[model samples]
Target: MTALPDDLARALDDALDRVPASRLAPVVERLIGDYRGGVATVSSRQGPILRTDDDAAAYAAYRMPATYAAVHDGLSRAAEVVGRLAPRTLLDVGGGTGAAVWAASRLWPSLRAATVLEGSEPVIALGRRLATGADDAAVRAARWERTQLGAATTLPEADLITVSYVLGELPEPVRETLVDEAAARASTVAVFEPGTPAGYRRILAVRERLIAAGMGVAAPCPHDGACPITGDDWCHFAARVDRTSRHRSLKGGTLSHEDEKFAYVVATRAPGQHADNRVLRHPLQRKGLVTLRLCTGDGAIADRPVPRSRREHYRAARDTGWGDAWPPP
Candidate 1:
């Protein structure tokens, strides 16, 4: 679980205070419906997701924390493998409210500049407002541009590019084009989506395209060969987020936290060291044995049991969680 930095949390809390949760509740509901049902095409009657200030505010309140946690987790995994990603610039495509920007800055404090390209003016405005209170200079001075992402859009060059929770909103062709463009423009690219079957399919497609574009996968997948887990199972990870009072109010949830399950791929221009195996599910502990489901570097999924007799190995297995690299890095 990755928590938002204190300054960023305070910034979000302050922004939520200005908008009444009562008004944002319905908007949040509508947004949820829109997301669950899938956003309609630009020509469709339903139109875009963030249409007004309230809509943007509601989206930020409901989604920012989860998106931040997902992106942070993905980046952290990438950092572990890639090692010392001293990226100076970042470009966040379709970055509604700049959640990805904050996540990236936290991991790579070396980031000196950032540009967030969003389609909604309200989202960009609200994102700018929230960023103004950020402690990170790069986040505070980030450039927010309103650009409709499509097949014809050209992405600016950057050391790192993040597209989080945005691909589902675009059509297939546009999704392919945007991903190809990101691969072409940035040295490193990290993409995130909902943890649904469809989201896994999209991530699989992106992974293939990125590898086709000559990019090397830096995280999640230990090998860039082919995803071995087949059938009904989808490759995704859970990121737990601590909800704010406003977050709970808007979503009308009684729990203090929520698990945001997301699928992501981190690819880089240069080849980097990869984990030997990636844990696919929570380790099952019973008696003196621990069962671990792992995606090995040879592009195969297997179940390995660690017995207590192997004290050091058993200890590592017991401590390992889902989505962690096996053998404790």
Candidate 2:
């Protein structure tokens, strides 16, 4: 629901100004290609993409805005399902440019302390510098730590932990370990990745792992039963953001906005009682009838139709948005 914060936008603009046109143009091109293809160029054997100031600036300019939008929507849904209890302490793993921290802080203003863990010093520096301009006192004072997160690492305890756009880079073994560590340390955990099938698969794996660890899903899923989705289809959602002129230029698109599709899961140690069916797609309204594709707690997909004759059901279906839990307020 929230766009990029104004302060954060200015910080990114400042970072972009520091980058030479020659240096920035190439990185932006490569970044656009990598992003469109759902490629993890940085996660490969060569290592992270943010090796220099130019790399950090270029990456931030091209990716941070969209990443922030996706995480912001994911966290907003988590808050809706888990009941608006703001956390005092927050942790962001693989917190490049501290985007997730900004999103979380914006979602829950009660946050008093925030910490970011990143492996690249260049990224940490850029993230810290950008964070310094944040309007939120907690975000501006966030602690940026440079550390590698692997199976053996111990995560600090916090009320909420967010891991966004970071899982695809790791080996399956390492991802398993990191999920375990995260589940062990936090009461609520939210993981987000690109909307690609691969990203959805990663989110699904983490969802199952967290459930096995006694955590319950708070959003996107109505129940812990095995995901009813199967075959070529995957579970994902979309959030639209206005494209800055610079963004349009870098991405080579004329559209004034872009829909950032993402896969995410928000799991809490204590599950909240809410709707038992999640609307899987936008309701198809036609000729006095509305049709909803739902993933029900019964562990199956149900296509239910509501004709105008059924006033309550029809109205509910007509108003339901994609990803909204059926019967939700």
Please report, in order, the local distance difference test score of every candidate based on alpha carbons. 0.90, 0.84
Per-model clash counts, in order, read 0, 0
Question: Candidate 1 — which residues are off by over 4 angstroms?
Answer: 40-45
lDDT of candidate 1 over 48-163, digit per residue (tens):
77889999889888989999999999999888888857789999999999999999998888999999999899999899999998999999999999898988888999999999
Q: For residues 1-329, what per-residue lDDT tens digits would candidate 2 score against the true structure?
A: 44678998998887777776667878888766665664563354366656787777887887898889998887777777777557889999888888888988988988999999899898898998898788999899999999887778789998888898888877787788878888999988989998889899999999999999999888788888899889999999888887787878776789988888899998888657345788888889899999999998777999988899999878888888888888774
- For candidate 2, the TM-score is 0.94
Q: Which run of 10 residues does model 2 get worst, by summed lDDT?
A: 37-46
TM-score of each: 0.97, 0.94
TM-score top scorer: 1
